[model samples]
Target: MLSTMRSGVRRHSALLLFILGAVLLTPLSQAQQLQTKFGCNMTRDEDGEKVIYGDTGEFKLDGERIEALRWESALYRPTHGFECSIDTSDDPQAEVEQDGDKSNWRITLKDPVAARHQRGYDFYNHGMNCSIRLQRDGDKLHVIPSCPALCGSRGNFTELSVDLKTGECSYK
Candidate 1:
């Protein structure tokens, strides 16, 4: 009887440790995999009469047609740690083309880590000393800038929203 009781206790303790380890690591691992799934472009419609946003830059939505670009922006997945490259056929002359190689890149998220709008939103090392908020609207996601002027206009705080299905962003 004594031996059986000791073994049972040992098993229970091991199981508890395993559960705790998983619970603690789950969030960290999931956080690293979160990324923005959609990007939008700014466009000018009807020759400065109106504008429609696209993935790259400003253009006439009606008078001029611009191709829409889409890409999945995932967190820096440590598992692969694969490098990234840029294709600028859309705008080869754009300044963004300068960073054709992924040798040097940086991304930041706000502090106090507000809840993510989607299952894949992650809190990474952002070099800022203010709170961050993410807003979502349909298939668009907007990053609420932490600039003093922006916050001041928005009651001194970052606001966030999310599209349940598309993980799009929009500012409120």
Candidate 2:
């Protein structure tokens, strides 16, 4: 009779432990919620290529994550990329004077992106690696991209800045 009680108690304890473990390990909606910080995501489909300016991707109401274009002919690279800066500034000369080392503005993209440049000449022939960063200043959003050796020259890294409020992106 005592052995029977001991066996039942052991079975109940095991069942309680299993229940406690299951409760602790459950996701409980944390896994299903959308990302709200820093704003980064990849495109789910190849639908943005249908248009010229590109389509919208994962973005927040504050525009932390704006629309990114991914359009590359499968024959070219079998991947998509951003072509230059989206909204070029009406005049880039003024911003050029303020350009400097933006090594700290590098951002790791969540999506595989491809970009093209129509410079006076494609000195490098191949696209250069770029580091894009975003900064909020008062009522403006600044998009900065740093490109090293764009023209294969020394001390001539191209740095660009885009004012989100005015939709003006210039070589800053």
- Candidate lDDT scores, in order, read 0.31, 0.33
lDDT of 1 by residue, 1-172 (tens): 9999999999999999999999986754433222333444333344345433222211111111212222211212223321111122212111111112111111222322331212122433332233222332333334443422112112233223345366454434
Which portions of model 1 show Cα errors greater than 4 Å? 1-4, 20-33, 43-141, 146-164, 167-172
Worst 10 residues of 2 by lDDT: 89-98
Best by lDDT: 2
Q: Estimate each model's TM-score.
A: 0.30, 0.26
Per-candidate total of colliding backbone pairs: 21, 5
* Global fold similarity of model 1 (TM-score): 0.30
Please give the lDDT score at residue 76 for candidate 2.
14
Stretch of 10 with least lDDT, candidate 1 = 94-103
Reference-based TM-score, model 2: 0.26
- lDDT digits (tens) for residues 46-143 of candidate 2: 35443222222121221222223221111111343333332221111111111222111223333212222333334444435534444444333344
